[model samples]
Target: MKGNTNKIIWLTGASSGIGEALAYELSHKGYKLIISARNEKQLILVKEKCKYPENVAVLPLDLAGFSTVGNGVKIAIAIYGRIDILINNAGISQRSLIMETGLEVYEKLIIVNYLGTVALTKEVLPHFISKKSGQFVTVTSLMGKFGSPYRSGYCAAKHALHGFFDVLRMEHDKDGIDVTLVCPGFVQTKVAINALIGDGSSQNRNDTATEQGMPAEIFARKMIRAIEQKKYEVYIGGKEIKGIYLKRFFPNLLHKIVLRSQYR
Candidate 1:
């Protein structure tokens, strides 16, 4: 992959999982990284694990607090001079059926997963536009393309990202701003355990499918390659990733298969 050593990349949700893994991958490739998450200590730990710790900065942020994201980006720009890439990887998930889910739970998931990401993207966009060069790498999900049982809110949030970022890519393409939406089928992240339940409570337990999902490091490496190629959208995972195409080309068969899948 082509390395952009001078590019400054700002990544959220860097405390663990795919975000942390990407920090290591990108840092090793020589990109200056600014990592953010609500967990300050964990963000520091991620920075320490980077090949070039001196090139990584830890910025703790809570995506749920969308109003403050602009200030956070301002602080990051102050430190890095300019941000060449914005990776919106911070998001929450839902692990309950819609009927069993509370309205507040749905709203919270939307706020953290969709709205917060959009807000942060908007915050960094002006800088990109002025410079006429930047990339926005969004970590959505395969759920964005196909709805699954027990994840109505998560599916909704992920689907919304597609609509939002797709438009951003079209509107800003001429400005040299590229947007890549990454939809992974099942990633072995703590997402399942951290997923919100119907009553707005954490599941606090990993699901079987998630346990068998792709490793974060492997996922991150593929993502880096996709970003380098400037692909507008890419799907990554194991066999499950094939569902994206199946869902598009053979809806009925895909529906039947998904309905009978053990992951549901």
Candidate 2:
């Protein structure tokens, strides 16, 4: 009824990692939540962990299934009549060099990461437009801002989100629609383990950098603060966030660092 209190928040990829942390964080702040993910079992577990479990709804969704996301959003909306925020935090990562990766892997990454997010956003856009008030929060990566080895396809997908959402923010400013692009460098999660490899198979291995990344709970806390402030774009991470600035001022230096990274 005041500020973010009692607002309805629809969050995707809510079963694990940053999404899971956010569920708890937002629930404690008194937001009614719709949590979605591919795994219903895990989603239920996340829901039960929330401070206000009764305020949460679990909707299982697979990002790759484009046609299904629309229905997912519809179900989410029915829970609270309207949704004040939609968080597009669902996506897959790549862990193979472009040359080693198959075309199908790139296609799959685009479908699940780029197109899937777009489809869901489009589904929710009409609702926001009708209300003339809503916020869209997308979780991209530090990789979105620059090129990185072994993540060619993943980088492409994230870059596409930046382009789409930047345009959306501009076009919908008069409609009072807010967009936040979150660029996270690394957080201790299973992302590396679940990243797609050359054949579209999971890498199943965690990179050393991922092992040394920020805790997901800490990242979620900062993210919630950014959302509350309605920042257009926010970066979170360790030294990796500096890459965004480095790419702007010292492109050659950042390129060299990327080439020398353990990724290669």
State residue 222's C-alpha deviation in candidate 2, in Å: 0.5
Least lDDT summed over 10 consecutive residues: which range in candidate 2?
1-10
Off by over 4 Å in 1: 1-3
lDDT of 1 by residue, 117-151 (tens): 98899999999999999999999999999988888
Give, for candidate 1, the lowest lDDT window spanning 10 residues. Answer: 1-10
TM-score of each: 0.97, 0.97
Off by over 4 Å in 2: 1-3
Candidate 1 Cα deviation (angstroms), residue 37: 0.6
Error of 2 at 48 (Å): 0.6
